[model samples]
Target: MSTAAVTDKRHSTLRAASLPRWTPWVIAAGSLVLGIGISMAAGLDSQVQWGLIAAVLFVLGTFGVAARVEGRRQAKDRVATSLVWVAFLLAVVPLVSLIWVTVVRGVKVLDVYFLTHSMGVVADTEPGGGIYHAIIGSLEQVGLATLIGAPIGVLTAIYLVEYGRGRLAKAVTFFVDVMTGIPSIVAGLFILSLMLIFEMQPFGFAGSLALAILMMPVVVRSTEEMLKLVPNELREASLALGVPKWRTILKVVLPTSVGGITTGIMLAVARIAGETAPVLLLVFGNPFINNNPFEGAQASLPLYIYQQFANSAGSGAAFDRAWAASLTLIAFVMILNLVARGIARWKAPKTGR
Candidate 1:
């Protein structure tokens, strides 16, 4: 035989057979049908069980077919890929279901009228109330908490990362770790106890303080991580140029990590926005519009939703309003996240190699 022909035959013989891309999709569809059929035969009612069975069947089918056509190594690789996809679906399915249900139920009563008006005189059993007051209170309280928490968090993180030493840094870090795990209710109770001592009435700013407490630890952790990611070379270069340590941090270190710090601040804001315990204990959930957060009781979205559901007993109007309020809170957090992402992208350091 000619050398060229021999080489071609050898290469062709060594090449392993691979499955078509559509093979997985076909197997998935078959697995789904078979899983449903088996569930029906077993008289099972759970959709979750059907999904689990389908996922198992899909992975098994991929392994079996690939092992038969290709080698066991290729089969194992395909199985791993199938398992990853299954796990991803398992995680995402529940989130999509929740958002889908919220949208379906919330759209019934969420509109311009709902957004513009307040609960006012409408009873929980009645259908005419809105979340205007709740929106205002949530905004003010969360904004105030952000104002209180963000600067302190950034400064603490800067101290820990840049100038930390000896027992002081360890103590500060230990406290931050403890604070991160502190329950939202505990923070609320702490503030509530202080309010009692000072004879302070429940007001919007009181809730803000509790929220700020919850926010600070998260900001500290996130900011610390971000600051650590900044290369030491940059700091050394700045110091070599005769820049003071504080000035180097303010001008270079902060600007380099500003994107991440801003994102952390926004995440902390979102974390506190939906808290009902502190607001319930402090703000007291006002029904009427209270534009001044520092002076009066306020109605946050969470408190409004909780009140509606708790007081309604079985009222459909109250349930609808609760769902609508939940949707609004979800939207607010989502907007904060989107804004954070935008700011992070905008402020991210440019790279030119």
Candidate 2:
């Protein structure tokens, strides 16, 4: 081939057609306008219908335009990208709507006074009480459950990852899997059966026992995964230094994975914090404040929300209290997640000097 012809071919290959950065925005605007026009012409009243139409139009328009301007390959890529964006928006919509509704309704009743007092003598319809008792019950129950569940779970995970070698290990693994799938209500019922046999009445400690059951499997699974992620070379190096297996695990392995373990524990705590069925079957939901978890029925936020909503009977005040409690519970869960993240970041192992 001639030198000029070779240069022309190389330049042509390098100068492939490219779309402008603003093309997606232009396509999206056109799709929205077209969708709105079609909705109006069809007399559609639902915003959801309009949004779906716009999403469909956006995907179709991007494919068609890219095919014409670029190529079939580019068109398919654009279509896939558009579909992913649409899916993300669809997933985000319900969460945004839920948070918005909660904030609007909850602020009507959430106040310092509402948080500091208890529903001692007030009627649900009248709604001049607070969730202090419920808050105390939740903290104590979750704290106690964590104390009981986390250690056992960590030790089980350590055994499974480090020393598991026989039928005993397989049996433990099978049972952990079984426990993972056990429903919260079933756990509560199991505890309830024990209580019945022992002639024990509903109390906060009973609820903690049920929550601990729910928490243990989660902790075991999370901690096991974290331990497995630690490099085997570290264990070998420790053994070469004449370190005991237990000392190696306690001094090196545990510190390296402590951040992940803490995160998992927080997640487990959040999972149990909002449980209503177990609390209902065990704690029994008291309206008045009771600090002792060992003896008397105690209130929890989830149970309080349920009771308030159930007793509302179309009463606005009662409904307001329910919404406020729901908001508080959500905030508590969110705070736990944030704290977990913070701890994970803070305790994460340093890789280099």
Candidate 3:
């Protein structure tokens, strides 16, 4: 090669034709407009149909335009990205819509007064009632279930992770797997059968037992995973220091994975918090306040909502109460999730590079 040609080649940069950074947004807007026009022209009234058309058009347009400009390889990558965005919007739009609708309908009856009073002496067909009793029942029942389930679950997980061996361990693992898939209604029925055998009446404690059954497998699975995340090096170090196995687990392993374990327990609590069938089959749904969970029927938010909606005689008041109770339950679950996130972040082991 000549010296001038070699120098020119070293200094030159290869460039390919590519779309602008804003090309996707422009394509999406155009597709949306075209989708709406097509839907209207075809006399289709479904917004979902319009959205599907827009998503399809956007993906097709991106692939075609990118292939023409940037080549087929880049076009396929763009198509994958487009597909991801479409799936994300598909998931998010319905969730946003649900929360929006719930908030709008819930605020009609949700107030401080609603949170403070019971439905004592109030007809389900009337407008004057509150979820105060339900709140009390839910708190007590879930608290009891947690107290019952969390420790046993954690201990079982510890056994599985640290000391599991032989056929016993296999049996425990098998049962945990089986329990994880047991329906809430089956738990309720099992408890119900015991109550019948003992000639007992519906009470809040019975509901708590069912919730505990539904809660344990989730706790066990999550806690087992968290315990496994604790590095073997930590356990080995403690053992090398002449520490007892139980003490080492308590001091080193448990502390290291405490955040994840706590998060799992909180999530388990949230899962059992919204259960209606167990509460219905056991607690029997009270209309008035019942503070003692052991002795009598009690109300829960889920049961309250179900009762109000199912029993109302074309009454707007009952429907409003159901929505308000739903809002409260959602708020409670959201708070638990937020708290779990906070605890996880705060107690998570700090990493150093």
Worst 10 residues of 2 by lDDT: 1-10
Off by over 4 Å in 2: 1-17, 350-353
Q: How much does candidate 3 score in TM-score?
A: 0.91
Off by over 4 Å in 3: 1-17, 313-315, 350-353
lDDT of 3 by residue, 78-147 (tens): 8999999999999998999888988998999999999999999988778978999999999999999999
Query: Which lDDT tens digits does candidate 2 get at residues 1-353?
Result: 11232234333433233677789899999999999999999999998889899999999999999888766776787899999999999999899989999899998989999999999998877968999999999999999999999999999999999999899999999999999999999999999999999999999999999999999999999999889878888999999999999999999899889998999999999999999999999999999999999989999999999999998875578899999999999999999999998997887655544
lDDT of each: 0.90, 0.91, 0.91
Candidate 1: C-alpha lDDT = 0.90
Best by TM-score: 3
TM-scores, in order shown? Answer: 0.88, 0.90, 0.91
- Residue 276's lDDT in candidate 2: 93
